[model samples]
Structures are given as structure tokens and as C-alpha cells.
Target: MTVFVDTSAFLAYLDRSDENHETAVATWTQLLHNRELLVCTNYILIESSALIQNRLGMAAIRDFQELFIPLLRIEWIDESVHQTGVAAWLAANRRRLSLVDVTSFETMRRLFINTAFAFDQHFVEQGFSCLK
Candidate 1:
């Protein structure tokens, strides 16, 4: 099975203080043990890296890059995906909804991925099944 990795999951897994940390760790371990295909957009990488660095410090960013990143099949967003994401973001018109989240939704739809390893309710609101 292919599971889309989101920034929420990354943060949760990396930050021990995060409320979702335990669940994230358990789910992540299961996914790795099952050898599930883990996927993510390049947008997620950028977002995660920045958050990790800001909240957890540079060492966490290193761990994110050297350890966690290798497990993901990154889907790089092009101009078309970016535009589509922007349109979705505008259409949603929700203040808290981010362009990255919309792009993730688009990426999942394009890849036919139904499951997401995420803590974000936006995924559930958008009708995608979230692992955590």
C-alpha cells in the first residue's frame, strides 16, 4: 500500500512533545515493518524541514534529511500542480487551510493514493483516510 506522508506526521514523529507523537511513532514503525510504500510531495519536504529546524533545531533537520527522507518516494510538484493547488486553496477559502495541504490532496488524487500518514484534519475533511 502507498501512504502519503504529510508535514503533520513528520512533525509528530520527530517532536516528542507533540501530542500526536506516540501515535505517530507507532504508525510509522508499523508502516516501515510492513514495507509500505511511503510517498510525499517535495512541498512537504520543504515545509517539514523548516518546521523541524525552527521547532526542534538543526539536528532534527539533519535527522529528517538523512533518516526520514530516505523512506519517502518524493513527488516533485511542477507548475501545473502548483496552479491546481492554488486554485483548490482559493476554492476552499478556509483561513487555516494551506496551499501545501491542497497540493497534497491534489498529489494524492493524481497518484490514486487513498491513505495518508498524517495528523492534519484537513486530510480527513478532504475525504482522505489518515493513519493517525
Candidate 2:
């Protein structure tokens, strides 16, 4: 199965202090053991890298890059995906909802991916099943 990895899950897995760290680690291990195909959009990579660098320092970012990044099959966002995500974000009209998240939803829909390895409730709210 292909699981969409989100920024929240990346943060949780990388930061030991994060509240969801333990669960994220366990889920990550299981996914890897099962050889599940992990995927993420370029948007998630950018968001995760920035957050990891800001909160955990360069070492953590290196770990994310060297250790975890290789396991992912990145889905690069294009003009069409960006435009659709922006449209979804506007239609949602929720301030707390992010454009990256709406784009993730669109990406998942386009890929026919039903599950996500994410800590964000927005994934579930958007009708996607979350691993954690």
C-alpha cells in the first residue's frame, strides 16, 4: 500500500520531544518493515524541511534528509495541482486549514490513495484514513 506522508508525521518522527513521537516512530517502523510504499508531495518536503530546521536544528534536518527522505517517493507539484489546491483552500474558507493540506488532499484524490501516515486531523477531516 502507498501511504501519503505529511509534514506533521515527519515532525513527529524526527523530534523526540514531540507528543506524537512515539506513535510516529512505531508506525514508521511498521511501515518500513512492511515495505509499504511511502509517498509525499514536494510541498510536504518544503514544509517539513523548514519546520525541522527551525525546531530541531540542522542535525535533525540532516537525519530527515539522509535517513527518511530516501524511503519516500516524492510527488512533485505542478501548476495544475497548485491551482486546484488553491481553489480547494479558498472553498474551504477555514483559516486554520493550510494550502499544503488542501493540495495533499487533491494529490491523494488524484493518486487514488486512501491512507495517510499523518498526525494532522485535517487528513481525516478530508475523508482520508490516517495511520497515526
Q: What C-alpha lDDT values do all the predictions have?
A: 0.95, 0.95
Query: What are the TM-scores, per candidate, against the unseen true structure?
Result: 0.98, 0.98
Model 2 regions more than 4 Å off: none
lDDT at position 99, candidate 2: 91
The residue pairs in collision within model 1 are none
Mind giving the per-residue lDDT tens digits that candidate 1 earns over 109-128? 99999999999999999999
Residue 31 of model 2 has an lDDT of 98
Task: Give the alpha carbon lDDT tens digit for every residue of 6-78 in model 2.
Answer: 9999999989999999999999999999999999999999999999999999999999999999989999999
Worst 10 residues of 1 by lDDT: 63-72
Candidate maximizing lDDT: 1
- Give the clashing residue pairs of candidate 2, or none: none
RMSD to the native, candidate 2? 0.6
lDDT comparing candidate 1 with the true structure: 0.95
